[model samples]
Target: MTLTRRTLLLGLGAVTLSACADTAPVSSLATTGLPADLRPTPNAAYDAWVASFRSRAEGQGISQSTLNAAFRGTGYLPGVVRRDRNQTEFTRTLEDYLAITASDERISKGRAAFDRHRSTLNAVEARYGVPANIVTAIWGLESFYGERRGDVPVISATSTLAFDGRRGAFFERQLVEALRILQSGDVTPANMTGSWAGAMGHTQFIPTSYQTFAVDFTGDGRRDIWSDDPSDSLASTAAYLSRNGWQSGQSWGREAEDGALQPQPGGPRFAVTRNFRVIKTYNNSDSYAIGVGHLADRIAGGGPLRGSFPPDQFGLTKDDRIELQRRLTARGFDTGGADGVIGNNTRAAITAYQTNEGLAATGDPSPELLRRLGG
Candidate 1:
């Protein structure tokens, strides 16, 4: 699991409802056919929760009607809370995760989207001094260029998480901010649907993120991140990077041919401007940062594999290495388990095979070795 924003939201919805219903009294609202564990609580607990949240919203200048309109009848969403709890364990290895998410399909679609919205993206770039490709890359990665911006109600999702008490304080603050957004007339309840964790719009912004960085690029009297128009979303992302110290004209790191480059003794060899660190704030993973950076580079017309990777000790392409592992296993060599990644087990197996064949026991799988093993 890559633990994208969608997964996080769904998990939050599940856990919140489960916790809320478990703590309710016997005479609480009956949840007969619901997922056994998740049920709505008695109106009293819910009402109390709403009242407390309402007071905070009111303190922030939100009116009573806004609170009522947003929270009335909004039950705890089990799926969203479950996602929030499970985010840590769901991430895949960085290479595999990035390969799937930033596949050629996504890249092709992203290019088309960029072309379609070039004027707005360019205008945003010019105004904010952030590159258009980086903005489009974030949009593509966050919500597949806005094609899948989620369907959960933002207020309901945030409120459920807050009441669930897992990360209660954090969610509570978001809930208050969400209500303030509604009160500010920026977006209505119906239009504020998003990930179950309460990240809304094309770029999946939490309510506070919207308050801090959203822009009304089209001057439509509303900062409409949910609209089909990409202007506001692109501008908002640019503003985020700019405020966080985006460099005016610098490259995010580039991919180098294997062994053609090496990291400096103390740091990464690739050049990462200040804006690159800003991207890391969105998701704190170097692989994620690099994938986004490289994808952005490609979208800007850079060629693939600028240099050749050093030959694997197996003397094979990555795909060929996997095939070697499979063939060695079929020959009863037990090259550990077939995982494509070269490891010590596979090297030992190759050494054993070389010894059996009266060849040099270099432990490196060359073409001659593959031929001898009937690969």
Candidate 2:
């Protein structure tokens, strides 16, 4: 699970927690792109839990009116429960992590997003003392530059997870904070949508983080992170880093030729600076921080890392992997655009090709397999 800004600020351990609800016909929840499992599903136990929770929420100073409005049409989201139960402690190599987070497409989009909102980003930097490119990189990673600010209703998602009770106490606190946000009129329950775990807005600030760092950059009296305008969200992100001691005009760090820190053996080593640690205060992962730094560099017209990563366990270099993917795709086995990342599609393509050729379908790439595929 990836840590939300709230978790980092609160000094809690890292875990992926991500998105929202309400009623008056519940303002018609955005179910169009949401997974079916994320939709409301009847659960007697969950209803009873919410019923009991209303009093605790009230005790926490949540108003009756807010509760009434928030719970309107909200119910158990089975998918939220499933997501809670299914979180695995997995780690990705720095190389692979950058491949996904700072990919060509993400870099391209980040540059365009930065350009499109240059004035706003610069204004945020002026106010917060964090660089524009670093903030933009964060926005790109957190929500694909606002392209995927989640659409699940916040009340519903938080309440459901709170009731699910794996991390019941934690989620209950989040639910309370969400209710408080609604009570304060920051946003309507109907419009308080976010990721399933309730990470909201463009930079995926959890409720507590939002309370601490969100700002009404547009001065419209609302810290509208969810708005399409993105000014508040971007500013809020800069505020987070600035409040946490980001050093303006300092590099997050660079890939050093003699750097001692190498997260993955035989991969490019990085000599991170104080600002790199500051970035980790947003998401406590070396890969995440490095991804932000490297992606920021790329968005600012910098080049790729100077060092190269070593081969994979299969003895295949990135070039070897790319050739494998290209060969497979050329033979009509689509490896999902040949990015050299052996994701499920690429593995499936390898399996299909092997099966068709009466070879074992290991789905693992190898020099032998690459040669067999006419690489």
TM-scores, in order shown?
A: 0.71, 0.93
Off by over 4 Å in 2: 1-27
lDDT of 1 by residue, 1-375 (tens): 223223233322211222222233322322243443244444456457866766666887878677666654456666565666767654444434445456677788888998999999899989988889988888888889999776566766777788878878877877887887878788877567676678888888877788888889999888889888878888988998888778878766565333222322222235555666767766655666766776776677765444333444445655676678888888878886665555679889888777877878888876666666674
TM-score of 1: 0.71
Candidate 2, TM-score vs. the true structure?
0.93
lDDT of each: 0.67, 0.81
Model 1, position 153, has a per-residue lDDT of 65
Clashes of each: 20, 18
> Model 1 — which ten-residue stretch has the worst lDDT?
12-21
**Best-matching candidate per lDDT:** 2
Estimate, for each residue in 1-375, the C-alpha lDDT of model 2 and write its tens digit: 245464512211111112123333422555545678777776778777887888887888888887887787676778777776776656667877888999999999999999999999999999999999999999999889999877877777777877777778878888888888888888886678888788898889888888989999999988899888999999999999999899887899988879878988988888989999999888888888999999999999999988889998899888888899999999999999866788889999999999999999999999999988774
